[model samples]
Target: MTRLISALLLFALACASAAVARPNILIIVADDLGWADVGYHGSTIATPNIDRLCREGVELNRHYVSPVCTPTRIGLLTGRYWSRFGNTGPNNERCLPWETETLATALRSRGYDTCITGKWHLGSLPEWGPRQFGFTHSHGSLAGGVNPLNHFYKHGKYMKTWHRNDRLIEEEGHATDLIAREAIRYIRMERDGPFFVYVPFTAVHTPFLEEKRYLEAVKHIPDDRRFFAACLVHLDEKIGEIIKAVDDSGQRDNTLILFFSDNGGQNPSSDDSRRYPDTKPTSKFKGMNTPLRGWKVQTYEGGMRVPAFVNWPGTLKPGRSDALLSVTDWMPTLCALTGFKPTANLKWDGRNIWPMIRDPSKANRDRTLYCKGPGGRTRMVINDGWKLIEIKNGERFELYHLDDDPNEERDLFHSEPDEVDKMKRILARERKADDDARPDPKRKNPSPV
Candidate 1:
């Protein structure tokens, strides 16, 4: 009788432990995808899987990121402004200092198996790789971007291509498919406990390539754009596959999926034309920022704002929000959700949005947000609806009232000098706080190959 009681008590404890395990996290980051690229945002592109995530989850309408890829990635990983850590440029080996605490590192400490399956543009150095940053397994290109067919850098100067656990390997399949297959494989094999999978798809970026079936499906839309659209479809299917894997593994209820783009889409022609001339000179796919001006490389709304959605079976409510959240907020928000404390010594620029996720109506992010770009030449600050932009050189300080002029058509720098002054003062204070929050001085930059 006593032995039976002991066995029953042990079973109850096991069940309770399984029920309380930290939620599995899947972060799907699309490369250079515009806000309008997804069906939820009104793009003609067929993104049913992504659209479903937005429909059944919360869509962050005013989500923002850095003006370019690498900077935005740095912000996403550290939950701090990229500029604060001197990671303000593209293709810079000095960015993302080794000692910085990454999302992968934080989650891994909490007993989660962390894996990254695509683009690690933060740094190309040996120490900067995913393994050094707490990811147990990583497979993908290390540079900002890669060619689809040959899996080579555009310039052909960088020899670093595909890598799997520190060993270079030749990859034959299309990049997007390769990433998706690896992500699913990880999910299948690592379902014992909570796991974090970072799938940063190289699709819909430059040198757009797709499988023959996908390419043939969209052949009617003109070659270049058709191929681009096909890539989107391929990405959608892969997203569905990943979601299905989680559901089939009985981990769906405890899995939280976050989908977002690294930055706004590039003008396909600008990059696509250089490689493929016969392909109908790539044109804008009309991603709906409705009133935002500019594209990928600018500090305007369209460039910085991208689609952000979160879906966790029983946690987040389904809806849309314009709460002005940035990608940097994910780290702290995820930490809060999983009951993990962020590093006490580190200062993060992002605020926890978990409360907002639970109840969107109660969401209010009032902190000032900052963005810095290449050479630290481009900078911008957002506080509520007002924004201040400071470009390099002697360019005039530009101010915009985003609430009223969403397209940023009219400059209010001279019209509302007092408001601009107030914003400037606020920005000054915020900048001081950020500058003082630097990482350890002894930390060295990762070496680039």
Candidate 2:
């Protein structure tokens, strides 16, 4: 009888240990946030909460994503490059197959409760939302960035994109506030297992609408950038709220929180607000990648390399690293960290970067990173420290050693014929894998960039 009691106690303790070992994962993604947008990155925008996390976490100074939102999200969730799905730009169609295994699904299989409360742009319809891809609970815009107050996407059948779980529901609040509210609610919920909370805020994205209170906070900024600054302030505050919720829940020590932007900032453009209901007349929407070349749509350092960091109270020490990491790496890294073993090969283009994140001293050199721009007009490959930008299948090429010219200002293609040949071969190899999943006969050289 005593032996039986001892065995039962040992089993209970083992179960408890397993639960504690698997930390709760919280990933917060900002839409269209730029490299120079965060307070730590020398932006004038007040991001106290984001800065605090950076100060308390490991900053990924060289982290990369796709040049656009949809591809970045696809890479993040699937642990593979968006080009694998033949996606180079944002699309309204379903991006994933029904049998796809996502970060949420992998974590859920390990007894973690997965929830996402913000932009689910991978698929616009309710049937194709986060739940279909393994999220147990999902809320916020199913489409891309929406009008801040009205919570509507661009004028179309998918305009009403807000939802909970698998159904679209009407809500009455600012989009940022609503998303944070749902995330905070989920964090505060009573549960038996660890949770995976993905909060992809739709702040600072488009239409440039912001609350007056946040606007007042950034009153010192110029008129052209005041609303954008206000959006940053609002986003920062909500991030603080969600972090506080985790702290209040006594899960701060047992939760790992990651924050990053989907892609780079956009230049002043009214293209996103076309045909939207009751929108103000076309005005400049401020976007800044400052000191980095290119905007949101190009595969330059400015477009793909946005702000990113990881925070866990006693786990990840505060520091900055220039390790070459991609957005797709999060799935494999987080799954490995939380003990979620994949049953089969997930065909991830990204490597597990936890080693580099845990210790900034460990550099990720010799890893190749590839990016294909919209319509396949431009392609970039970074191997070692050299970067090659090929336009329309070598019709025009720009090469730079990022170790020296991180801004990509110097064109070394004509100077180094040998390096250009080597990079072209590498780029060609990477391109061969593109469009294999969904073959596009028009994947050939797109229009000139």
Candidate 3:
């Protein structure tokens, strides 16, 4: 950790001496993408573009996010655990408060053109959409996952979440293609300075729809697996196109491209499928996060631990960081990299991890990573190598030494009573209980669909 701090200081000194050009930022988030789904993670799904990044970029091997969409998005934008806001589930209601500063708004203040071209589940309505909160140009689904071709939000009041800017609109194309093209168009648009593009693709989430080409490509796979594989291929190809666009714009050298999942993949049989109204009736959908226990909405590794990498050709050194990185770290980290001083009251729980990313050994694993499952029903805290998980009303507790039991197979509740007590106390201190969200109906039943 001392080495990491020293590296951070040295980097700061270098930046102070040199006039480094502000780099363009591209953050791509895939919904419900499994930890092992990408080619870099040994999945057979063709993700050559993503795999390329892993080979030449700083792969974040221990990145953690919330178990679901809204919380993860909240943390990424606010640099604070979403639990502090009190809502955990999908947050279908008003999510971010008006006073909150988003990643786009922060970068926009630094003369960067900001745009978002994908899912915006922060608040599931046009009135509470991306334009109202930082993104200068916004398009695609404003709600959670939507019907890929139909562009509907799972048949609800905000079913028509598809839009351009803050107004509803209909565009004829695959959602993935449309999002990638919008991002490409945004990159090509004449702008005065650097840009921040946030593309949160709604693919691999639900309502599993794929075009004929992708379907035919993955035809060898059976049933839902084939459909899921096609979705991955579509997403991967679109990502390749977006990266090409950045390269064509001559921003490749300075652009910082980040790719990660919003949360772990969903296992329909183990998950509350009821929430996914548009999902088709397949025997058992293919979303693999093997060697990890539990699915989304649970305080398990499979739910929060996800795939992430940062590729900046001239800046970050290519390597892997097993450090405890979180979705909340981006805001502060970017602020540090771009020299954006935040307001006094914007208290952030995440620290600048520039040095840590450059070298994995600088990982300060002692920092507590607090996680609150959907509905505040489940809570988790990991400090150092020990972890503690507790069910709110169920009055259940599970403890594990993550260093020795990364799979969380052996519960140390009784074997390591002292460790359990210590972690429980730590969790008590970290749990920020708040109740400002819509009720999560899916928590009671795993297969809602």
Against the true structure, whose TM-score is highest? Answer: 2
lDDT of 2 by residue, 330-387 (tens): 9988888777778888888888898898899898778999999888989999998999
Score residue 124 of candidate 2 by CA lDDT: 93
Put the candidates in TM-score order, highest first: 2, 3, 1
User: Which candidate should be chosen as best, given lDDT against the real structure?
Assistant: 2
Can you give the TM-score per candidate against the true fold?
0.88, 0.92, 0.91
lDDT of 2: 0.86
* Deviation in Å, model 1, residue 85 alpha carbon: 1.6
lDDT of 1 at 152: 62
Please identify model 2 stretches exceeding 4 Å from their true place: 1-20, 281-285, 439-449
Query: Poorest 10 consecutive residues of model 3 by lDDT?
Result: 440-449
lDDT on C-alpha atoms for all candidate structures:
0.76, 0.86, 0.83
**Model 1: clashing residue pairs?**
36-287, 291-407
Give per-residue CA lDDT, model 1, range 198-219, as digits (tens). Answer: 9998877766656688877666
